[model samples]
Target: MTETTMPAAPGAVPHRTLPAGALPHDWRAVDEGWGRRGPDFATLSEPSACREYVALHHALGVDHGDHLLDVACGAGLAVELAALRGATCAGVDASARLVDVARVRSPEADLRVGDMHDLPWPDATFTVVSSFRGVWGTTPGALDEIRRVLVPGGRLGLTVWGHVKASPGAWALAPFRLAAEPQVRNQAAMTSLGRPGVGEAVLEAAGFVDVRRVRIPFAWEFADPATYARALASTGPAFVAIQEVGEPAFLAAAERGATAHVRAGLPLRAEVDVTGFLARTAAAR
Candidate 1:
C-alpha cells in the first residue's frame, strides 16, 4: 500500500518535533512494570477493559474488510475480539511477557513486542488502529507513528481516563496514591490527554482529521476487596505504588479503599469515566 500525506489544517495545534534519536518516554520501565504480572494482568485486569474495546471498535467501524493494529495491546484481548469480528488483526506492545500472553490468546495475530513510538510495520499497513488507554498525553509521538502505519483515511480510536476523581468509582484508583509523589505526578501527566480539548488538539497536531470524542464505558468488578486489591496490583500504575510501599502495603491500601464500595451480595463495581477519541488519517489529496 502507498503512504499518503496531507498538509496540516490551518490554525491546527502545532506538532512538537523531537531531536533525532530521542524517545518521548522510558518504554523499558513501562515494559517491566506492565509485564511484571503478565498472567495476572491478562486474567484479572484486562477483562475490565472489554467495554472500552468493544465501544471503540464499534465507533471505528471495525469489520471484515479492515486490517487492524492495536497499539499497546497488553494481553491481546482487543486483538482477539477484533479477529472474532472478522478483521485481520495485529498488535504491538512494549512488554514481552504480555505479548507472550497475547500471542497465546490470538495465535493468528501478528503480535510483536516493540515500541509504539516506532512500530515495526510498514507505512500504510493497517486500515484501522486502536489503543485503549495505552497512548497517553506524554506519548503524542506515538500518534505520528500510528498515522504512518495507517492507510490513507484509515481510522484511529483510542481511550484514556476521563475526570477520574469525579467518577463514582474513584475509590478504585485510590491505591495508586500510595506511589511516591514523582510517580503520582507522572501519572497525572499521562492522563492529561483525557482532559477536554487535549486529545483532539494532539490528534490534529499529528495530522489526523475529523477528531471527535465520545464517552466510553469502563468498569472494574471484583468478588471482594481482596480480589480488588489483587486486580489493582496487576496493573502498571499499581507497580509504582508497590515499589514505594511494598506489595503487601499497597495491597492493604487497595483493600481498604475498596471496603467502602462493597455490597451485600453484588460484585464490587467501580465505573470510571473513560474518554474515547475517533479520528481518521487525512484523505488522499
Candidate 2:
C-alpha cells in the first residue's frame, strides 16, 4: 500500500506522516486497550521495562548529564528511569487517559498527550530520544521528527515488538483467537516486533547515523493459572481478548492448561523477542 504524508495538526502535538494508507482504521483498538488498564499495563511492564531502559543507557554510553525523552511512554517507567540517571526526562504519549494515570502514578516525570510524528519541543532539544513499542506504523515523516528533536551527537533508542511466533510470552495468544472485528484480528496477525525495524532503515532515512539493533529474548513466567491470569489482566489487549472469549473462569482454565507442562515454582515461560536499537542523531557532515 502507498503511504501518505501527514503533518502536525495544531498546538503542541506532533504530526505523524506514515506510509500506511489505512491508519485511520482501527486506531481505537490500541487506545481502548491501553485505557482500560493503563496502570496495570504500566505496572506489569515495570519489571522487564526497567532492565530494557537501563540497557539502553549503558549501550549508548550515555552519561547522567544528557537530556532524555521517551516517545509513547505508557506509564512513565522509562521516563522515571531517565530521571534517575540525572537527565532531564520527559515523555509524550497519544493516550490522554494513559498520560493522566502516568502523572498520578509517577509524579517525578513531566508527561503530555501528543503525537509522535510532530513533537512539541524545539529542534535538537534532547540528547537521547527513545521509544518503547510506539513506533509501529510510523508515517514517512515520523522519523524526521525523531531526528529533529535530538541534538547533534544525541542518540535515538527504540524497542520494537517481536513476532508472536518467536515470542514465547505470546504463545498462548497464538491459539486464543479474538472475536473482535475482522480488522482488529487481522492487525493482530500483521503486526510483529520486527514490523517496524524499530532499529533499521527508518533511522537511516531520518538522517541518523551509526544505527544498530540487537535481539534480546526474554520470558514471562507464571507459577500457575491463578498468577498467570492476574499477570495477563495487566495487558489491556490480552484482557479484552480473554474477556471476549469468556470470563475469568475460562481464561484461568486456559492458563492452567497452557501452564500444565511446567512444575510448581517454575513459571510457565512465555517468550518475547525484543530488538533494542541505538542510533546517533548527528549533523550531516
Candidate 3:
C-alpha cells in the first residue's frame, strides 16, 4: 500500500525537529508521566512486559554482536538483559528519571533521553529495533523513524495490546478512557492491529516485509487492590487520567476498578492478551 502525507490539522502539535539529542517540548508530558513511575515500572510493568522482549529477541535471532535499539525503553531492564546475553544494547526514552534507572541497570549500554519520533542516532545504526508496548499503530511517523534508524533488512519487533474484549483485565482501561483526550483514548484502545491483517498492513506501509504477528500471554498480578491501583495509576494512560481528573480522583477511580477485579481471594489479576509483530525492512538500496 502507498503511504500518503497528510497536512497537519489546525493547532496540531508540530513535529519534533530538534537535534537528535535535544528534548522536544511536546514530549514533556511523556517524560514527566513515565518519570513519575520510574521506580515502580521496573518492578511492576517490566516483569510482565519483559516476556515480549525476550520473545522478540529470540524470534529475530539476536546475537552478541548485533546492535539492538530499544525505543521507549523504560528503566532499561530489557536492554540490560539483552546486553547480558551479549547483544550490543542501546535504548532511548522520553523520561529522564527512567533513563537514570536504566543507566544504573545497564551502565555500559548507551541509554539516552530522546523523542521516539526523532531518535538520537545516525541513520541505519542498528541491526534490530524493539519496542515493547511503546509504539502504537496510530503513530506511523514514529514507525518511519524506526525504519530510518534500522539498517536495511534490519528487523523490527513491536508489541501492542490484543483485542481488549478477549482480555480479562480490559476493565483496567476505564479510568484512562474516561479521562484522556479522544486521541489518547483511541490510541489506548489499540484497535488497529487487533484487526486481522491490519498490523501487517501498517508495517508494509512503513517499508517492511515478512510481517508477522504472534500472540503472547501477557498478564499482571498484584497482591492487593490498592497497590495494584496505585501502580496502574502510574503509567502513561493514568498520566492522562491524572491530568484530566487530578491524581486523587484518578487514584480513587483506579482503586474502584482494581477492586472489582479481585477474585477468589487471590490478588487482583489481569490477563492481558498481547500481540507481538515482527517485520524486516527492504534490503539496502
- Give per-residue CA lDDT, model 1, range 75-160, as digits (tens): 89999999988999999876777888999999999987666767778899999999988888777888888999999999999998
Candidate-wise lDDT, in order: 0.82, 0.61, 0.73
lDDT of 2 by residue, 1-285 (tens): 000111123232313443321122233344555656666566553454555667776776656788887887767777777776778777876566677766775676667666666676788888888876566543436677888888888888776656666564665544234435653554453344256654476667778788887664445555566656555555554545555666565466556657655666676666666677778877646
Supply the TM-score for candidate 3: 0.87
Number of the top lDDT candidate: 1
**Candidate 2: worst-modelled 10 consecutive residues by lDDT:** 1-10
* TM-score of candidate 2 relative to the true fold: 0.76
What's model 2's overall lDDT?
Answer: 0.61
TM, every model: 0.91, 0.76, 0.87
Candidate 3: the clashing residue pairs are 64-86
Task: Provide the clashing-pair count of each candidate structure.
Answer: 0, 13, 1
Error of 1 at 139 (Å): 0.6
For candidate 3, write residues 1-285 as lDDT tens digits. Answer: 000011111232323455644565666666667778777867765665666667777887888888999987878887977887789999987778888889998999999877677676889999999887777655656788899989989989887777876677877666666554674546644446656788888889888898999876666778877777777766776776677789888878878888767778787777777888989889967
lDDT over C-alpha atoms for residue 189 of model 2 = 39
Residue 108, candidate 1: Cα error in Å is: 0.4
Error (Å) of candidate 1 at residue 272 is 0.3
Please give the RMSD of candidate 1 to the true structure: 7.0
TM-score of 1: 0.91
